[model samples]
Target: MKNKKEMAKEIIALVGGESNIDSLIHCATRLRFTLKDQSVAQKSELGKLPGVLTVVETAGQFQVVVGNTVGEIYKEIMEQTSLGEGESSDKGSRRSKGSFLEKAIDVVSSIFSPIIGVLAGAGIIKGILLILTQLELLQKTTGTYQILNAASDSVFYFLPVVLAITAAKKFGANQMVSVIVGLSLLYPGLVTFMASGEPITFLSIPVLSGTYASTVIPSILAVWVLSHLERLLTRIIPDVLKLLLVPAISLSVIVPLTLLIFGPFGIYVGNGVSSLYNSMYELSPLIAGLFVGGGWTILVMFGLHKVLVPIGLNDIATLGSTTIFAFAAPANLAQSGAALAVAVKLKNKEMKSVATTASLAASLGITEPAIYGFNLKYKLPMIVAVISA
Candidate 1:
């Protein structure tokens, strides 16, 4: 068997080497690459590589599916390439290749991927707390419960700050500045003022006060603008003065812009999406459930499921619960069930072992291993799983 390092090197080479790669980011189970030239990539060769489950080309990304070890493989690739240190490198050619929708998906996925694991952990803690409280095992009033609840909710509460850092990385802006912008939005004084229903203004411009914490679009838009503004400043500002001026200017401009424009716009967008989804669910929950349940895995296959993650998160933030996960859980479990059946029925020993492991992983709510590794490999199982979901 090839070691992870060897596999990583081979995977990078097959995907047209470091120079061909414009950027690389990994999700839970795949190393997603934006290549300068996709045609040069040896996709078939990559799928045949040891430890590689499959190759999925979608949303302008060349995704190498390596199942659970994707993180290790991604680390190896980064260590072997310049990508980690080349965040500011020009990617115009790469950017120009994808359609607007593809670019949007790629950008959103990259921005959100780094934090998904932590989000899942926090969510699990919340879920466990809920279960404990419902069973009367833990009182909400207890210190233990309060501490655990804070631990779980902290990520969501400070989500804008967290997202600002990630979005800054995605947009190639100064991370600290982006974080400051996010922090400004959620600053205790500002939040308190907004809650108090007091009028505020920035330089005579009336700021539209709204909740920024736990929201998605505002921080992203702010960081995106910051990226462009930073570039312009770099070009115009004297090199010696830039050290002092760039960040100072960016903060002054972006903070107010975010407060006055981006923050409220994002709030509206988030609210609109949540409202639309809820309205759809209310109109015909059966159809909504059926569509989300049956097609969730399909969306995952194309890396489009991420588009719904924020909506689900927004639903939780605004409505205290979400239908997205409610429908998705059964879909995930159905994949596990289908994989379990595959494990039992497969005659080949190696195949059975793979199916068994995939089954276990899918059961734990990480379904990529099962979907790409076993279920999708067999059409009937995937079809049955979809229908079952």
Candidate 2:
């Protein structure tokens, strides 16, 4: 196998060198690049690299699949090239523009990718705590239980604040100002005031009463608006006064706007989507199950699966659970089973090794290696996996 540096170097060259890259980021298993000229990228050659699993071009990204080592590989690429981590020197002007759906997926994936690992860890802790309490192994009234519960719940409780930092990065807005916008939504005083059952107003405009903790859409929408407001402020405000006025003006304007408009609007949108999904599920569980089970991997292939994360998160926040993961779990495990079958029957040593490792990863709920590196490569396995799922 090639070393990380060598692999990174080869990848940079194959993607039309450093100059062609407009920006770069990575998810759990792929190096996603936005290129200035997609035609110049050597996609087939990138797939042939030793460490590379495959290459996929979707959602206006040239994605190089490299399994779990994607983070380290991304680090090596950043170290060896001029490309900034998740930021472009060109400010995205030269990058390929995708359709509205593609742009939405790109934005959602980029905002969530950096935080998914910690969110999953917190979720696991919560699950374990729940199990312990259910089994009578731990008392919810104990100090230890209280501390652990806080640790697990903090992520969700402060989700809007965390999402603000990431959404600011994705939208190229002022991070601190974005954080302030998120914080205002969850401020203790405001929470108390809103919960008081009295009317709330900002400069005579009525503010909607709603909870923002553990919610997803409001922070993102707020930061997206902040990005544009910052740009306008930057242009109109003098350089000498920018440092002082920009943040102050942004917060003063955005906080009220978020309270009066974005926060309520986002909550409504989230509730509407959740209700729509529930109605679909209520209409026919078997059909919904069949489609999500069979087509979830297909959505992943096109990078559209990320579009569902917010919906699932919103459902969890509102409804306490979601059906998406319930259906997806079977699809993932089925792919693992199919890959194991391929591993057992394959005569070629190299292909067999890939299948074996990919199968193990898929069983642990990381199915990209299995889907792209094994099952999808062998058409029969993929078809069988989809049917079985």
Candidate 3:
């Protein structure tokens, strides 16, 4: 509320001032930095900063989770600090692999970093729709309901596009090309082609047993393959024509392959996963809950969650119900409980301040900082919450 400038300077001073940092950037809710020396970072003071949540040193970066206000604070930090120009990425490694403590922090940061922002958007819209529907402001018969539903749903409806864009970058592929590949599977002709009345078979194999829209793994897998193809093309193509030739060839080869092999298989795999999940739920709702509810935070914290998201969406698309979504609800509920527990347990005044903020975030089902910085490190309370659920 005080704006980014005032609070950032206070944090800059706390974390050994601007002098201790080498570079900085931010995501939706975290100020990620590289510090001159971990020893100099005044974690205690940083925790006391007005807007600061907590200082996290993990994932080869110094992280300050600022909830929704991070981007503004990041700009302020960039403006006030004399961090050097764009330089080489300083990839850091922790003390030892044998340490379970280090591995736990690594897992938490790894899982939560990328997925949190998009999840917040989706959750907010969903929450808003829930509010409107309860208030009777969005009637089922009205356009308001349809429009708001579209807003609430597209994140899950056309999720493959979002996954494609992010996963391509994750896999070191050209994002635009990867997005093109993802969208192509949704093309009207392609949908019609796959669902055609004619019996289409390739080498005695059915062309497509399922649709690819809103899927997760296939587009990502295709991009991974395309990235290698791009790298290989990079080696052979003349430097003069590399830019043009690379895209042309990559698209030409990748698109066909994606359609022929990747799209169909990705759809099949996604469908198969849903089928497996359906069987699980039919046997025992509690077992289904145990997998998704107990493991949701763990999965969301790690990049692996992206793999299951498509199946959840696929179930909604095809079957009109999703057990994974139902399961995810309990995990979030447990996260809120664990966050409240941590807020009660931490004694350091600075840590207390961060815990208070994180408790609020978790109550709203935004647990990135709580998971990445505190609950994960402390380990016991978080694990208890998941296991209890």
User: Which of the numbered candidates is closest to the native, going by highest lDDT?
Assistant: 1
lDDT of 3 by residue, 1-389 (tens): 45678888877876677767655655556776656676777787776665665666664456776766786777777778755333211211112132575444433333234555665577578778789889987777788778777876776666667766655544457777778877876788867876876766655766544576666656777876887887788889999998799889998887677767887787777778788888998899878888878888876564234345556667876676677866776676677677778878878887877777776776666667677557777898788767866
The reply for model 2, stretches above 4 Å from the true place, is 85-96, 347-354
Candidate 2 global TM-score: 0.94
Better of 2 and 3 by lDDT: 2
After aligning candidate 3 to the native by TM-score, how far in Å is the CA of 328 from where it should be? 3.2
User: How many pairs in model 1 have backbone atoms within 3 A of each other, for residues 3 or more apart or on separate chains, i.e. clashes?
Assistant: 0
Model 2 agreement with the true structure over 1-389: per-residue lDDT tens digits: 89898999999999999988877888778898988888999998888899888888888888998998999999999999867754521242242477987776788888887877777778879989999999999999999999999998998889999999988877788888888898998999999999999998877888889999989999999998888888888889999999999999999989888888898899999999989888888999888888788888888777667777788889888888999777877888999999999999999998899889899988767788998887898899999998988
Please provide, for model 1 over 1-389, each residue's C-alpha lDDT reduced to its tens digit, 9 standing for 90 to 100: 59989998898889888889888889888898988899999999988887888889999889888888988988999999888885743431135357999888888898898888889889999999999999999999999999999999999989999999888877788888888998998899888998998889878889887877788889999998998999899899999999999999999999989988998898899999999989999999998898899899999898888888999988887778999989998888999999999999999999899899898888777889899888888889999999999
Pairs of colliding residues, candidate 1: none
Each candidate: how many clashes?
Answer: 0, 0, 3
Q: Which ten residues in a row have the lowest lDDT in candidate 1?
A: 88-97
Q: Which ten residues in a row have the lowest lDDT in candidate 2?
A: 86-95
Error of 1 at 325 (Å): 1.4
lDDT of each: 0.88, 0.86, 0.68
| TM-score, per-candidate, Cα-based | 0.96, 0.94, 0.66
